[model samples]
Target: MWGREVHSHRVLITIRTKFMARDVHINSYLIVATCGGKAKREVSLEELRDHIHQYYIPLGRQFMVLFPEGGFLHKRREISQRFAEKNNLPKLEYVSLPRAGAMKVIMEEVGPHRDQAGTSKSDDRKDNNFNQNNVKILDTKSGDNIEWILDVTIAYPERVPLHLADVVCGFRPACTTHIHYRLYPSAEVPSDPEAMTTWLYDRFIEKDKMLEEFYRTGQFPPKGNTPLVTRPVRQDNVRYFILHLFFIASTFIQYKLWCAMWSCIW
Candidate 1:
């Protein structure tokens, strides 16, 4: 399995997992769903950690999806702005400040061993032990560990975000949904909670700028201030690539069928 720490939805995650992950010659993967926020029962760190150990590591799931923003943009914007104001942090209008507790747990459990790695000595936040009375279960090995953190910023056509209901009910017409990706080595990520919080804040701030540009110009700017080195997209064997199109189609069909069955059962 290619370890990925990303923020993504299920159907797309399924496709990416099929493309990047396999176990014992099988192209299959599992998803673990966890919630954030207080309205829907504030999830305890211990419970969240247990879920990862209980489902993800044991089942050998490839992707651990996280919505570090904790809630939808509209729902959390005011709260985030207030917190930012109180903390003297930059007021981010486009992206919400990320909650770092869950991120911290996942990284420590599966990224690098605490014994091997120490908390970052950065001045962003005082060096602190956030995870206290920690009892870890995941066997952290070179073969089994998170290697990449994919920061995926999804931009819908016309800056309108779509919901699962829209996709399920066929209310919205098909349109191009642009996704910009910035991948970070998991090793490069700060291990400690405070440093990780600062890291997430920095990422969201960058996202805010990207999003503002996207909304204004109708296209995401090339990553950072650097010039884009343009190259033609590689086209694989036409016959082989045609087969992949069929495969992707089959996945969407399967997903629709599953949704239909689930709706019936419920």
Candidate 2:
């Protein structure tokens, strides 16, 4: 099973079982499904996890296939590893298959039909650009932001659907609360890799043993996104780089002036 997406479905071929039943048991299973938003409809990663555990685990089936990109699947890897460590079950592994290889099989099995499929329209792109551009970030200790503005008219001449773009863009739901915010400028919109590191550190790591506790309980604490006040970090780096270059140019001018004065005296 790849996911609920009509196009990316799969059938289970075989069940491989490995049981280490100590005081605690570490059962495993593979899950597959499509990845998309809430309103579009279909099976969710959490639903798949529950389904696999309910149907297969008790029946002596372990090891589930999961879409590499699925959201809930992420917590599984972390939780399983923690369970294995605490109870000393065994190393847990999560495998990811290429989209074509695994996703194709799942879609073939379930045969789901998409309501609105295919490339997005120009108007859709324009709308996304407009929304992101006007998006306001509020409630931070520091005023730092990654500007996502665009010339909407030029960028999206006409309306278009954005299903494909959403997947490729790595957009995910985040905790948003309205609070006072300040603005910081950036040369380019900060990328996800950079942002995630900051988020993991400020939001996850900074918490007192949150990673360990979350792993043990299989629960994520409700931490407001206030901790992610590091947009200025990226912006500061960019600003510093620009300032350093300016300083170098100023130093060069001073050297030239000094040389000219010395040359005239000589």
Clashing residue pairs found in predicted model 1: none
Residue 125 accuracy (lDDT) in model 1: 26
Top model number, lDDT? 1
Residues 1-266 of candidate 1 have per-residue lDDT tens digits of 23443332212120111011111111234332224445432345445555555556555666666656645677667888999999999898777776666567667666654446543222122112232244233444534567677787776776667777885566997676666777777777777677878988888888888888988997778865966443334435698669878998999999999999999999
- Clash numbers, per candidate: 0, 34
User: Which 10-residue span in candidate 2 carries the lowest summed lDDT?
Assistant: 148-157
Candidate with best TM-score? 1
TM-scores of all candidate predictions against the true structure: 0.64, 0.17
The total of clashing pairs for model 2 equals 34
How far residue 188's Cα lies from its native spot in candidate 1, in Å, is 1.2
Q: What is each predicted model's overall lDDT from 0 to 1? A: 0.59, 0.31
